[model samples]
Target chain A: MSSSFDPSKYPELKNLLCSIDKIPDVSDIRPETVTEKVIECNSNCPDPRLKTLLDNLTIHLHDFIRENNVTTEEWMATVHYLTDVGKKCTGSRQEFVLLSDIFGIAALVNSINNPSVNGSTVATLLGPFYTGEFHDIEEGGTIAPAEGPGEPLLVTGRILNTSGEPIPNAAIETWEADAEGLYDVQYSTYSEPDHRGRFRSNDKGEYSFRCIVPIAYAIPDDGPVGDLLIKLGRHPYRPAHLHMKIEAPPVYETLVTALYPRGDLFSKSDAVFGVKTPLIVDFELIESDEEAKAKGFKKGPFRRLDYDFTLATKEESAQAKEKLRKSMAKKA
Target chain B: MSSSFDPSKYPELKNLLCSIDKIPDVSDIRPETVTEKVIECNSNCPDPRLKTLLDNLTIHLHDFIRENNVTTEEWMATVHYLTDVGKKCTGSRQEFVLLSDIFGIAALVNSINNPSVNGSTVATLLGPFYTGEFHDIEEGGTIAPAEGPGEPLLVTGRILNTSGEPIPNAAIETWEADAEGLYDVQYSTYSEPDHRGRFRSNDKGEYSFRCIVPIAYAIPDDGPVGDLLIKLGRHPYRPAHLHMKIEAPPVYETLVTALYPRGDLFSKSDAVFGVKTPLIVDFELIESDEEAKAKGFKKGPFRRLDYDFTLATKEESAQAKEKLRKSMAKKA
Candidate 1:
C-alpha cells in the first residue's frame, strides 16, 4: 500500500510524510467496529507506552461517547469550550491546568505517579498560580511583603524521612494567598514576588517562615472552566491553603502538596480537589506580646502553625506506585 | 455543609457564585475513590443530560488513566497537545474538529446520531475543510471555475427517501478538492470558491452539476493532530471524496456525507476514518467527444459520477438511534 501511493503528483508531500504501509481497514466501520479500527490504526506507534496510552484512550473515549449517547451538538459545544480554555491560557495563566485540576485529573495523575507510601506527604495539584519567579527567603523570614495585609503567621516544620530521622537542607518552595483572597500574581501592578518564597531547611531539617495566614480564595472564573463549574453545580473556591513543594535531593521523591488550615469553609470540597485529610493542620492563636515578638510578629494575637513533612525515598515511591499498578493490572 | 461555608469574609464573592450546597467529601481521595468523589461532587448539576454526560466522561477517563497507568508526563503532554489544537483554531480553521476526525471520534459520533435505517445512506463526519462560503449555482450549471485545474467531471444525483420516493427541492451543498489536492480555501489566492457550490434538487429530486474530479489530499499537517499521526505511524491523506450536505427540511434528517471514488490509494485508510464501503462509488471514464460536449465539457476524456442518496426521515433516524441506545443500555 505504501508503494501504491503515488507521491509523484505532489512534490511538497513527496518525502516529508511517508505514506503509511500498514493501515487498518476503516472502510466498513460501524459503531461496534470504529473503536477497534482506531486502536489498530495506532498499533504501529514506535513507543509502546504511547501506543498503549492511545489504545486505552481510544477505548475509553469511544465507550464514553457511545454509552452516553453524546449528541453532535453536545460534542461540538464541548470542543468549543475546550478551545476557549486553551485560548485563555497565557504567560500568567494556564486554563488547561485549571481544567484538569477541577476535573480531578491532575490530582489523579499526581496520585498515580506519587502514590502514598511510608507515611510520606501526599502530593496534590500544582495549580496555575505557581510561577518560576519566587525570591529566596531565610529561616524565620517573611514571604509576604514587609508591611503586607493580614494577620501575621508563623509556620515551622521539619522535613523528616519515614524512619523519623531528620532530612536536613531540603529545598522548600512555599506560597499562599493573602488574607484578601488574592495571590501576588492576581494583582495588576505586580512587579515583585510577595507571599511566595524559596528557601532551604536548616541542618536540623527544620524550616520556618513568616507570612499572612492563608485564606479561602476563588479561582479565576472568567474562563470556560469557570463556566463549567457553574453548570456542574460547583463553586470556584479553594479552602485556605499554603502551597508547598519540598525536595530532599538525591534520595527522596519531591513532595508537591498544600497545607490546609483546619475549619476552612471549603476544605472538604476544595474546588481543585487538592485537600487531603492528613495535610490539614491547626493554627494556634497566641495573644502573648513577648511570644509574638519572639516569633518576629510586630504585635500579639498572631497565628502559629506547626506541622512536619515526612519524605519517602525515590525507591519507596516507585515501589509503592508499582504495587498500585500491579493491583490495577490484576483487575484489568 | 451549606451553612458551613462562611463566605462572610470575601465580599467580592458574597452574592455571586453561591457556594455549593451539597459537595461530597474529597478529603481521603484515592484512585479507587477519586472518580466517585468527583462524580458525586457533581451530583447537583441541574441538567440531567449534562450530568449523565459528565458522569460517563469521568468514568471512562479515570478508567483509561488508571488502567493505562498514564504517567503525569503523558497526561500533561496530551493536555498540552489539546491546548495547541485549540490555539490553532481560527476564523478559517478548526483544529479540534480535525483532531476528532483523525481519532475517528467525529465519525463515530456522526454514526451514532445518524444511524442507518432501512437502506438509508449513512451519515459521515462534517470535516474541518467545510466552509460556509460557497456560491449558489443553478441546476445543470458548473460549480468549478471556468479555468480550474482538474479532469472534467459531471456529478448527477437524486435525493430520495427510504421508500424510494423523491425528496423534492432538497438543499444540496457539494464541495471537492482541486487536481492539486487542495481545497479552494487552501490557496493563498482564494478570493472565490472554485470547486464548491450550494444548489437545490430539481422538482424531480435530481441534482446535477459540473466539477473537477476530486483528488486525494493531505490534511493540514503543521498542527498537533498531524504530529500525532506521524507518531502513530499513520499518513495524513484523505481519499478523494466529494463532500455533500443534503437536507429536505421538516421530514428528512439532514445527511452530511461524502462519496469516495473507487480505487484511490487512501480510500481503505482514510486519514479521518470517514470512509464507509457503501459510499464508495464508481467514477466512469468517458472518452467520447460527443458525450463530453453533451455534458458541457470542452473536450473528451471526462469523468461521470452518478449516485443516488437515500435519506432517512427524521422519525426513522430517531427510531433507529433509540433502538441502538436501548440495545446498548441492555448490555450496560
Candidate 2:
C-alpha cells in the first residue's frame, strides 16, 4: 500500500505533502481490552474443547502479567528460562513433566481423570521416570537385576474388580529407584531400562516382583526447574515410591499410579505433591531362610510388601473421563 | 538416614543397601493449598519486587491451569512449543523479542517508561532489528551504503529542547528497511548493518541523511509468535517507518523511537502496536535538480522530509525512572 503523493512539482502541493496522515491520532486501547480480544479471537478455534482451554489459559496469562506488572526484562528472562527447560528434555529426562510434577499439576490432572471409586486404588502422579519399555518378568521374578544396588524387597499385589472378583491376566508394570535414590534409566553406568519390568497376574489375580525398596530422592536439580525450586525455597525431594501402571481387558481402564513407603520423611512434603494416603504402604520384615530358599533366593532376610489394587468398573471410568472432559471444556 | 532394619541375615542387603531413608505416608494436601503454600513460601525473597512479581505470576499460572482444567497432553504441547521458540533463537535472531513485539508488550513497556512530556518526541518500540551497532555518517550522506535498493530520499530535522532552543551535536541513530521491505540486518546478502547508521546534528542542531523511503514490512513470522499471530488472525505487517534513537548531553534524555510515513496502510494497525499520533510525518516531493544539488543530492525527483523533534527536561525523565522503579518494587 503506497502513500498518496504527486510526482509533479508544485509549490501548493509541497505544503499538502507534509500534512497527509502525519498524525497517528488513534486512541490507545487498554492492555486489558487487548487481552479480551485475544481470547475472543481464539474462540473460533476448530476444536471447541481446545478453544475453551486456550481461552482460559490466555486469560490467566494476561492476568498474571497485569497483576505482576511484569517488566520487559523480566518477561524476556522468563521466556529464556522456559526455553532452557525445553532444551534440557531428552529421551531419558522430561523437564516439562518435572515442572508439572513440582507444581502439582500432574497430581491435579491425575485426580481429575481418575476419581477414587469406592474400592479402587487411589491414583497418584506417574512422575517423569516411567520409561514404558519394561520387559515382561515371570511371576515373582526379580525386576531389580542382580547388577543394580538395593536391599532385596518383594512387592506382591492382587488385581481385583469393585465386586471383589479377580481380574485374571492383568498387566502390572512397575519401576523404582535403587537404594541410592536413582532410577534405573538415570544411571550413567547403564544404557538400557533397568529395575523396571512388567508382570502378568496369575489365574488367582495375583502379581509379584522382586525389586529394591525405593529411597527418597530429589528430583533432577541441574536444570531451570531446579533453579526455580531453589529460588522459591522449596525442597526437591520426593518420598520413596514405586511407579506403576496397571491395565485389565474390557472390564477396566489403564491406571497409572504410584505407591509410597509409609513414614518417609519427605512424605508430608513430597516435592512434587504426588503423595496420597491410600497409596502409602508399610513394609514388614521377614526373616525366614527356608522361605528365601524356596523363593530361589540365596539370602535370608527380606522386606516384603503386600498390597491389593482395586479397579473401577468400565462404566465408572467412562464417567470420570466424561467429567474431566466437561470440566476442561468450561467456557470463559 | 538408613532404614532401621537388620542387615546381618540379609547378606544381600549388605552388598546392595545404600541407606534408604524410605517412607512416604503423610496426610495429603489439596492442590489448591499447595499453590497457596508455594506463593506464601516466596514471601522471603530477598528482593521484594521480584518476590511479588513471581508470586503474581505463579498465582496466575496456577489459576490458568485450574480454570482451564488443562489436560496433561495440552500442557506438554505448550512446553514443547516454548522450547522450539528458544531453540530458534540465535545471535542474529531473537524469537522472544519478536514474541514480545507481537503480543504488544514492547509497545506497552515503551509507553510506560516514556509518557508524553510537553513537546518531547513520542517514543515507540526499539524492535529486534536494531543491532545496537550503528556507524556514524556525515551530514546529508547516504545511509544505504552502496548496495541497498530503493528510491533516493532525504530526511532533515532539527533537535530542540521543550523551550524550542536547538540542542547542538546530538547523536541521532537511524535504521529502516529498503524499498523491498527488508531491513539490512534481515538480509543474508549483507552481513553487516547496512541501511542503518548514526549521524550527528550540525551547529544549529540540524541533521540530514540520504536513504530510501521505508516500506511497510512484516515482522519475522517464521516462528511460534508468527504462528500465534496467524492463529489469532492478526496481520504481521508494520507501517512504513524510520527507526531512530536520539540522545543529547546532560539536559536531555535518550529517546528510542520511530517516525512513520503518513497514509501508510499499517500506520493505524502497526503489527507491534508501535505507532503513535505525533510520530507520523509527511514526505514532500522535490522535483528541482537545482534544489537537490544545493541539498547535496546527485539526483532530482527525490522525497524530502522536514521535521523537528522535541526533548523532555532532565527532571521529567528522572521522575519517570523513579516511578517505574517504585512500581516494580511492590511486594505481596
Candidate 3:
C-alpha cells in the first residue's frame, strides 16, 4: 500500500509531510485540527462570565475569517492599532477606557448595571483624573485660590437626602483647571495644591466657594489617544465645568457630577459625551457694583451659580452598590 | 463680596488654592468659561453613535468606580494588562483577535453575519492558519508527493449542488500537515514543495488523493496566544483533519470544509469550539495485500475515506454572495 500510495494525489498531505520531514521525530499538524486547541484554551477560562465571553468570541472571530476570507495582513494591522492604544496610557490617563467608551461596550455595561434611582442624580464616567482623596474644607470657602484671571464667582449648592432632607455635613470634593483650563497636576509651574479643592457643606446643606470661573478645556492631546481622536476626526474640548463628588451617608448615595456652564457651544456636544440636561446650569452673571458690595467685594462684574442635589434612598443606594459589585466580580 | 468670600471656609478649597499658585497657559487657546471649555474640549464627541456610546459608558464606568470605589492602583493594573495584550501581536498573528475570540464578540459577529443553508454543510470559524494562494494541479493527481509517514490512504470526495446534482470541473484546493503536525510555512528545515498541493476535480466531480493519515496536534506556543492558554490552564491540541476548498462555476457557491478524523478526542471538544458533526468522517483501515500489489504497494493494511460535499443551489449561492458583498460594503 505504501508503494502504491501517490503523494501527488493530495497536495495538502504532501505539504504536511514535507514540513514534518524537516523536523526530526515530530509529526506534522494539520490546519483542520487547530480548532481544538483554541476551544480547549477558551473553555477553561477561570471567570465563568469571561469563559462564556471568550467562547462566544472565538466562534464569531473564526466565522468572520471564514466568511470574509480575511487575510493575514488585515489581521496584523488591527493588532498594531490596538498596541498603540495601550502604549498611550500615562499615570493619570487610560486609552483603553477611551477605546471602550467609543466602542459602546462600556456604555452598554453601564446601562445594564446602573438603573436610574427615583431622586438620586445619575452617575457618569469618572474621567481619568480621579485621584481618590480630596482635601477637607469648611463651608462657604473658596475652592479656587490662584488669582490668575477670569470673572470671580461664588458657587453654592446644597446636598439633600432622597426624602428631601439636607445632608448638612456632606463632603464635596471639587477639582477644576484654572482660568486657562490647566489642572494643577498638568503644570510644572503649579504647586501640588493648585486648582483642586475639597469643601464640606454647612449645617443647612449649603456650600459656597470663591474662585475665578474655570475655562472650558481639552484633554491632553500629545499622546496616542490624541492620535486616535485625529483619526476619528474628533476635537478634544470639554465644556467649562467643575468636577464635584458629594458623599454623605450611604443612604444619600454618592454623586459624581460635572456642572457645565450654560451656553457653551460644546455643552450639548461634550467630547466624552457626558452632558445631561440636569447637569447644565447658568453661571448667572453678577454686575460687580451692588452685588459685590453686598458680599463685601470691592470689585464689579462677577458670576454666581446656585444648584441643589437630591440623593437616592438608602436601600436603593445599597442595591446599586450590590449590582456594581456583581458586575466587577464578573469582570475580574 | 471679597471680604465675605472666605477661602478658609472651605478646607478643600484651601487645598486647591494652597497646592499651587501658578497654572500654565500652555496653548494660549483658552475658552472664556469653564463650562464652555468642558463642553467644548473635555467631551466634545461628534459621531452620533460614538457620542451616545461615550455618554452611556461614562455613566456606567463612573457607577462602577463609585460602587466599588475602585482604587487608582487597581485601575492602573487594568491599564497595564491591556497594554500587554496590545504588545503581543506580530506580523502573522493577532492577539486582539484571540482576545476578541475569547471574549465572544468574534463568535457573535459570525453568527449574526453567517446564517446557514438547509441541508448544506454548516460553516464554522476559520482557525488561524490560512495563507494565500495554493499550487494548482490536475484532477485525480496526488497532493502529497513525498514519502513521509502515516497509514497510506485514498480519499475520494464529490462536490454537488444543494439539489444533489454533481458539479463538474470544480477546483478543490487541499492541504494538510504530515503525521508530525507541522506546516511548511512554520518550519524552514523543509523545502517549500514538500507537503502542500492543490487539485481540481474531474468532469464527474470526483477527486482522489494519496497521503499519510494526519495526526491531531496543538497550535504554536511561545507567543502571546500561548501565554494566554497557559494562563487559562488549557491544552492546545486539535483533532486530526484535512482542509479543502471547493469552488466551481460562478453560479455554484464556494465551500471551505474540514473533514475531521472520526473518534478523535478533540473532535467533540475542539479548542476553538469549531466542531460540527457533519464535518466528521472515518478513515476505514482495510487489509488489502492483493489490492496493494495492483497499486504497486507491498502492504497488508491500507486506509480509505469516501466523502461527498453538497453545496447550496446556484441561485441561493448567488444570493449569499450578494448579501455578503452588501454587508462588507456597509462595514467598509
Candidate 4:
C-alpha cells in the first residue's frame, strides 16, 4: 500500500472533493437541526410546564421561519418594529397589549380560559384603561357630569344567576366615550369621574345610569401600533360600546365585557376584534315624554337600553379561577 | 291569521328560541377570519414588496399562535422579555443582534449572501463588535501591545486567488481576545489598539502578526440574553478564534470571516454556531530560542500558524455586491 493516498484514484472521493468548493443554497437553514438544538437547550428546564411551553413555542416559531423562508432584512425589520413597540410603552400606554387586542389574541385567550356557563355573560378584553377604581354613584344616577355630544341615553340592567334569580348588591363598573368620541383619559383637561362611574345593584338586582349614547371611536393611533394599522389599511375605529366589569357574589370569576349597540356602522368590524353578536343590544328610542318622565327622565327623545347579565354557577366559576391561578403560577 | 302564530305549532322553532339564549364560547377566535382581516387591511400598501412581506409575516405569526395555543400569560411573558431586551440596548450594546447570532440566524444569513466561489474562503458573521475602523500597521508587525500569560503566537498568511496567484496589497483587519479571554471591548479598563490591528499583505501576498494565543471566552452574560442562556441550560462560551475582514481591489464584497484554533474546548460547539471546520488551523509549536530569534522573536517557546485566504472571481464578487445592495435598498 502507498504511504500517501491519492484521491484521484477514487471516483467517489473525487466527486466529494469536487463538491468541496460548491456554493451552498443561501436560504438553506437546516430548520430541523436548529429546532433540535433549541429543544435540547430547554430540555433541562426546572419547570416541566415551562419546558413544554417553550418546546411548543420553539417548534411553532421555527416552523414559521422555515415556511416563510424569511430573509435577513425582513427579520431585522421585525426586530426594529417590535423594539419600537416596546419603546412606545409607557405608564399610560401599552403598545404590545394594543397589538394583542388588534390581533384578536386577547379576545381569544379570554374566551379560551373562561368558557361560558349556562347563560352567564362572556368575558372580553379588560382593555388598558381600567383603573380598578371608580367613583361610587347612587342607583339610577347619572354617570355623565356634563354631556358634550351625542344623544341622551339611559342604561338599565340587572345581574342575575342562571336560575333567573336576582343577585343583590352586585358591583358594576361602567365607562364610555362622550359624543365627541373621547374617553375621559383622552381629554387633556379632563378630571376624574366624568362619563364613568361605579354603581351597585339594588336588592332586586336592578341598576341604571344616565349618559350620552356611546359612538364609534378610534383608538389612539400616534404610536407604532397605529402605524401598523395604517399600513394594513385597517381603520382604528371600535364600534359604539360600553365597557363594564361586573362582580357578583358567589362567582369569583369576574365578568369583564363590552356591550355594543346593534346598529353601529363598525359594530361588525371592531378594530380590536372585541365585538360578539350576543353582546350587541339595541339602543331603543323612547319618544314619549310622559313615559320618560315616569322613568325619572326629565326630557324626551332619549335612548333606552335594558340588558340582563347572568353569572355562571359557582362550580363553573371555581374551575375558571383554578385555571387562571395555574396559568399565572406558571410565570414564576 | 295571527301574527304570533306558529312557534307553538313548530317544535323546531321553539327549540331554536330556547337555544338562542345559550352562552357562546367567548374566546372563539377563528384564526382564518383574523388572518383574512389583517391581509385586507394591508391590501393598499404603497410598496408591493412591503405588502408581500407583511402578508407572509402575518400569516406565520397567526399560524404560530393558533398552532401553539399560547396562553395569555405566556404571551405577556414574551412581551416582557422582548421589552427588557430592547431597554437593555445602548450605544455600545445590541442585545437583538446577539440574540440573532445565538439563534444561528446571523451565520445562515452570512453564508447565504456570500457563498464560496471556487474554493474562496467562506464568509461568517461580522459579529456585533466590528466597528469598521482599525489602526493600520506595517506588514510583519505585532498586533498585541504587551505579552500576557498565554504562549506567544506568530501568525503568517497569504492572500491569493483561486488560481494560486498572489493578490498583493490586500487589506486585512484582524482581532482576537487576549490571554485573559477578553476582547478590548469587553474590558472595563481597556484602551484602543490592544490585541487588534490592521495590516496589508506585501508584494508576495504574505503577511505576519505576533500576538498571544486566544482562549475560549464567555459572551456577555449579565443581561437578559445571559438570563435566557441560563434558563435554557446553555453556556455562553465561544470557541477560541481570530476574526478577519479581508478586502482586495475590484472585489466589492468584503469577506468577513474568522479562523479558529484546532482542538479548542468549544470548537465543535460554538455558542453562536459560527464555527466551520474549514476555518480551523493547526498551530505548530517551536521550542528553540535560536529558532525563535531567527524569526525576530526573543522567546524560546512559541506557536506558529499559517493559513491562506482565497478570493473569488469578479463575477462571484459582483453577485454578492448586487445582493447586498438590494438588501440595503429595501431598508430605505
TM-score per candidate, in order? 0.93, 0.83, 0.55, 0.75
User: Which one is best on TM-score?
Assistant: 1
lDDT, candidate 4, B1-332, per-residue tens: 00111234333234432442231222224434566765654554557766776676566566555555566677778767877777766655678777766666666555545667668887776777776556777766677764456678888989888778888888899987777776777766645657778988899989888876777776766788877766654556677888988888675346788888877666655667777778877889999998787666776688899989888867876675466446545632
Give the count of colliding residue pairs in each prediction. Answer: 0, 3, 107, 5
DockQ, per model, reads 0.50, 0.23, 0.08, 0.12
Candidate 3 lDDT, A1-332, residue by residue in tens: 11222335333235433443231111111222333445544443556644544444444444444444333344455546676775565555567776654433233333333344666765554666666645555555565653446667778778877667888888787877776667766665644565567877888888876766766676665666655564444545566777778788655656776677766645543446555567777778788588776654456687888888877766786686576567656754
Looking at model 1 chain A, report the run of 10 residues with the lowest lDDT sum.
A1-10
Report the lDDT of model 4 for residue B306.
90
What value of lDDT does candidate 2 attain over all alpha carbons?
A: 0.72
| lDDT string, candidate 3, B1-332, tens digits | 11112235333334332432221211111111222322233243336544443343333344344334444344545556676776655444555666554433333343333334656665554555545446665544455653457667668878777777778878776777666676665575644544456777777877776666777766665556556655554544456777777778677656666777777645643434455677777888778798755543456576788888877766775566466656755754
Among all windows of 10 consecutive residues in model 4 chain B, the one with the lowest summed lDDT is: B1-10
True contacts kept of each: 0.56, 0.19, 0.10, 0.15
Instruction: Report the lDDT tens digits of candidate 1 across residue range A1-332.
Output: 11224456444444434544445677767888898999887766778888888888888888888888889999999888877887898767778888888888888888889887988888887777888678899899999876567878899989999998998899999998776787788888889887899999899999999987788877887889888887887778888888999988799999888988888888788888888888888888899999988878777888899889999999999899999999988877
Please identify which of the two predictions, 3 or 4, would achieve the higher TM-score against the true structure: 4
Worst window of 10 by summed lDDT in candidate 3 chain A: A23-32
Task: Give the top-scoring candidate (lDDT).
Answer: 1
Tell me the docking grade of candidate 2: incorrect
Shift of residue A215 alpha carbon in model 3, Å:
5.5
Runs in model 2 deviating more than 4 A are A2-27, A40-51, A184-190, A249-251, A318-332, B1-27, B184-190, B248-253, B293-297, B313-332
Q: What is the C-alpha RMSD of each candidate to the true structure, in Å?
A: 3.3, 8.1, 13.6, 12.8
Any idea what lDDT model 3 has?
Answer: 0.57
Encode model 4's per-residue lDDT on A128-210: one tens digit a residue. Answer: 67756577888777777633456778899898887889888888999877766777766667567567889888999898888
